[model samples]
Target: MQHKVIIAGGGTGGHIFPAIAIANALKKIAPEIEILFVGARGKMEMEKVPQAGYKIEGLDIAAFNRSNMLKNLTLPFKIIKSLNQASSIIKRFQPNAVVGVGGYASFPMLWKAQRKGIPTLIQEQNSFAGKANKQLGRRANRICVAYDGMEKFFPSDKLILTGNPVRSSITQSAVTRQEALMHFGLQDGKKTVFAFGGSLGAKSISEALRNILPQFVEKDVQLIWQTGKLYHDTAKAAAVPYASHVKVFDFINLMDFAYKASDVVISRAGAMTIAEECLVKKPVIFVPYPYAAEDHQTFNAQALVSKKAGLLIKDSEVGKELGTTLFSLLQNKALIDQLEQNIEKLGNSNADMVIAKEVVKLMG
Candidate 1:
C-alpha cells in the first residue's frame, strides 16, 4: 500500500530545503509513497516545492508581524480560514502523516491533523524552539530536532535529535576543488572565500563585502559571493574593479560547486547553513542574524564555536570585524585545518534518512 504524507514549511531556504530532503528520503525508501507540501500562499515554498516535483497546497495564512504590531490584527481570522482550508485538504488527500517543519503555514495544518487524531510530526531546525512549535509539541507525536537540550521546550520522550536534513547533493557532494574553481572561472591555487547570508542577502554582510572588495583583490584571494537579490546590483558594481578576482551572483543554484571551491566560508548561522558547513568540512565564520526568533542563529553558531568547530561574530560587528577576521583566518592554515576536522565530526550526513525512517515508524 502507498503511504501518503504531507510535509509543511518554508519561509526560507533553511526550512524548504530540509522539507524537500525529507520528502526525497521518503521516496527513496518507499518509491510508491505519495507526498504533498503545504506552505504560505505567496512564499518561496509555493514555487520551490513544485520545482522539486511535488504538488503543494497554499494557505491564506500570515505570520504574526513582529516588526509591525498592527499588521497582526487579522492574524486570527487568517488562521481560522487556513484551518478550514487545511481540513478540506486533509479530508481529500487522506494523508497517513502530516509533518510540520516550522512556518506559519505548518501550524494550521499540523494543528488540524493532531485534532483529527492523525499522526503529526514537527521538525524544529533551530537550537531555540519557535513559539508555534512549542505549542504544537503538546500534541505532536514526534518532535524532530537538530540540537540537543531541546527538552526544555518539548517533552523528552517525544524529542528525537536527527540533526537538520540537508539536500542530498550537499551531503554527498563529489565535485573537486579544481572542477568547482573552473566552474566559477577562478584559478585553482588561489585562496577562495564563499560567502552567502542565506537565501535573502543580508544587508550587513553585503555592505561589509562591498567595503572590502578592493582588499580581496590586493590579497590575491578569489571570491564566490551569493549576494541574494537585494544586494546583487550593489555587489556587482562593487566587484567591477576586482572582477577577475570575484564571481558574484544574486543566488548560486550550484551550491555543491560553491562548497567544493571554498577554502573558507562566511555565512549566516541559520540551522541549515550550519548543517551544510559541517558536512562540507570547511572552516566557517558565522554572523548570526540577530533578529532571528529568540536569536536562535547565535545559539546555533555558539554550539560549534564552543567546540572550536567554527568562529562567530555579532551581526553588529560585521563592518568593523568581518573583513579583517576573514582575511586573518585565510592566512591561518593550522587553525583552518583544526576547524575543518572538528566541524566534520559534527555533521550527520544521513539525517534525512534517519528522519524518514522515524516518520514511517511513527505513522505506522
Candidate 2:
C-alpha cells in the first residue's frame, strides 16, 4: 500500500520552510509516498504550501490572544471548530502518520490523530518547547528536535536530535560573492552587512540600523537590509540619504545571494534563521525578539553564543549597542573566522532526510 502522511503546522517561515524541507526529503527518499499539509486558515502556510506544490487543508484556527483577554472570548469556539475540521481532514486523508511542527493548527490535528490511534511525530524547532508541543508530546511516537537539552521539555525517550531543516537553496546556492554584491548594486572592496528580522521585519533592528546609517557611510560599510513590509516605507525613506551604501527591501526573494554577498549578518534569532546561517557559515550577531513565547529566541541565540558560534545583543540594547558591537566585530578577522568555523560544525545539511526517515519508521 502507498503510504500517506500529513505534515501539520506553520505560522512563520521558521515552521513553514522546515515543514517544506521535510516534505521534499520524504519525496526524495520514497518516491511513492503521498504527502499533505494542514495549516491554519488565512495564515502564510495556506498560501506558501500551495506554492510549494503540495495540497493543504486549512483549519479555522487562531492562537489565543495573550495581550487582550477580551479577544480570547471566541478562542474556545475557534478551537472546537478547528478540531472538527482537523478530524474531517484526517478521516478523508487517512494518513499513515501525522507530524506536528508547532503552530496554531498543530494542536488540534495532532490531538485528533492521536485520538484515532494513528502514529504521530512532533518536530520541535526551538530550544524551548511551545506549550502545545509539550502537551501533545506525551503520546507522540517520535519527537525530532533541533537543540540539545530538550529533554527538559519532552519525554527523553522519544527525543531525537536531527537539527533543523533549512531550504536547499541555502545549502546548494551557486551564487558567488561578486554576483551577489552586483545583484544588490553594492560595490566590492567594502565590508558588507546583511540584516533582517524575519518575514514580518523587526522594528528594533531597523531603528538601530537607521540610527547608524551615517556611521555606515563614514566607515565605508555596505548593507543589504530586509525591513519587512511594516517598516519598509520608513526604512526606505531613511536610506534615501545613503542609497549607495544601503539597499533596503520589504522582503528579499533571493536570500542565498544576500548570504553570499555579506561579510557578516544581523538577524532575529528564529530557529530557521539560525539553521540557515549555520549552513552558510556566516558570523552573525543575533538580536532575539524579547516578546517571543517564553523568551525562546534568547534561548536559541544562547545555544550558539555559549559555544562561541554566534553573538547576542538583547532586543532592548539594539539601539544603544548594536552599531558599536557590529563595527568592532567587523574589524576582527580572527574572531570572524572562529565564529564561521564553529557555526559550520553545527550545520546539519541532512536534517530533513533524517527526519524523513524517522517519519517513515513511525509509519511502519
Candidate 3:
C-alpha cells in the first residue's frame, strides 16, 4: 500500500520553510509517498504551502489573544470549529502518519490524529517548546527537535536532535562573494554588513541602524538592509545620505546572494534565521524578540552564545548597544573568523533528510 502523510502547521517562515524542507525530503526518500499539508486559514501557510506545490487544507483556527482579552471571546468557538475541520481532513486523507511542525493548526490536526491512533510526530524548532507542541508531545510517536535539553518539554525517549531544516538554497549556494557584491551594487574592498528582521521587519533594528548610518561611511562599510515592508519607506529615506554604500529593501528575494556578500550579519533570533546563519557560517549578532513565547528567541541565541558561535544583544538594548557591538565586531577579523568556525560546526545540512527518515519509520 502507498503511504500517505500529513504535515501540519505554519505561521511564520520558521515553521513554513522547515515544513516544506521535510516534505521535499520525504519525496526524495520515498518517491511513492503521498503528502498533504494542513494549515490555519488566512495564515501565511495557506499561500506559501500551495506555492511550494503541495495540497493544503486550512482550518478556521486562531491563536488565543494574549494582549487583548476581548479579542479571545471567539477563540474557543474557533478552536471547536477547527477541531471538526481537522477531523474531516484526517478522515478523508487517512494519512499513515501525521507530522506537526508547530503553529496554530498543528494542535487541532495532531490532536485529532492522535485520538484516532494515527502515528504522529512533532517538530519542535525552538529551544523552549510552545505550549501547544508541549501538550501534543505526550502522545506523539517521535519528536524532532533543533535544540538540546528539550526533555523538560517533551518525552525524553521521543526526542531526536535533528536540528532545524533550513532552505537548501542557503546551505548549498554557489554564489561567489564578488558576484554577490555586484548583485547588490556595493563597492569592493569594503567590509559589508547585512541586516534583516524577518518578513514584517523589526522597528528596533531599523531604528538603530538609522541612528548609526553615518558611522558606515566613516568606517568604509557597505550594507544590504532588508527593512521589511513596514519600515521600508522610512529606512530608504534615511539611507539617502549614504545611498552609494547602502542598499535598502523591504524584502530580499535573493538571500543566498546576500549571505555570500556579507562579512557580518544582524538579525532577529528566529529559529529558521539561526539555522540559515549557521549554515552560511557568517558572523552574526542576534537581537532576540523579547515578546516571543517564553522568550524563546533569547534561549535560541543563548545556545549559540554559550558556544561562542554568535553574539546576543537584547531587543530592548538595541538602541544603546547595537552600534558599538556591530562596529567592534566588524573591525575584528580574528573574532569574526572564530565565530564563523564555531557556528559552522552547529549547522546540520541533512536535518530534513533525517527527520524524513524518522517519519518514514513511524509509517512502517
**Which parts of model 2 are misplaced by more than 4 Å?**
none
lDDT of 3 by residue, 1-364 (tens): 9999999999888899999999999999999999999999899999999999999989999888779999999999999999999999988989999999998899999999999999999999999998898899999999999888999999899999999998788877899999999999997788999999998889999999999999999888999999999899999999999998899999998899999999999999999999999999999999998988889999999999999999999998999999999999998989999999999999999999999999999988
Over 4 Å off in model 1, which ranges? none
Provide TM-scores for the models: 0.98, 0.99, 0.99
What does candidate 2's lDDT look like per residue over 120-219, in tens digits? Answer: 9999999999889999999999999999999999989999999999998888899989999999999988999999999999999999999999999999
- TM-score-better candidate, 1 vs 2: 2
> Ranking under lDDT, best-scoring first?
2, 3, 1
- The reply for model 3, stretches above 4 Å from the true place, is none
The lDDT values for all models are 0.92, 0.95, 0.94
TM-score of structure candidate 1: 0.98
Q: Candidate 3, overall lDDT?
A: 0.94
Indicate the residue-level lDDT of 43 in model 2: 95
Weakest 10 consecutive residues of candidate 3 by summed lDDT: 166-175
Clashing pairs in 2: none
lDDT of 2 at 191: 98
Candidate 3 clashing pairs, residues 3+ apart or interchain: none
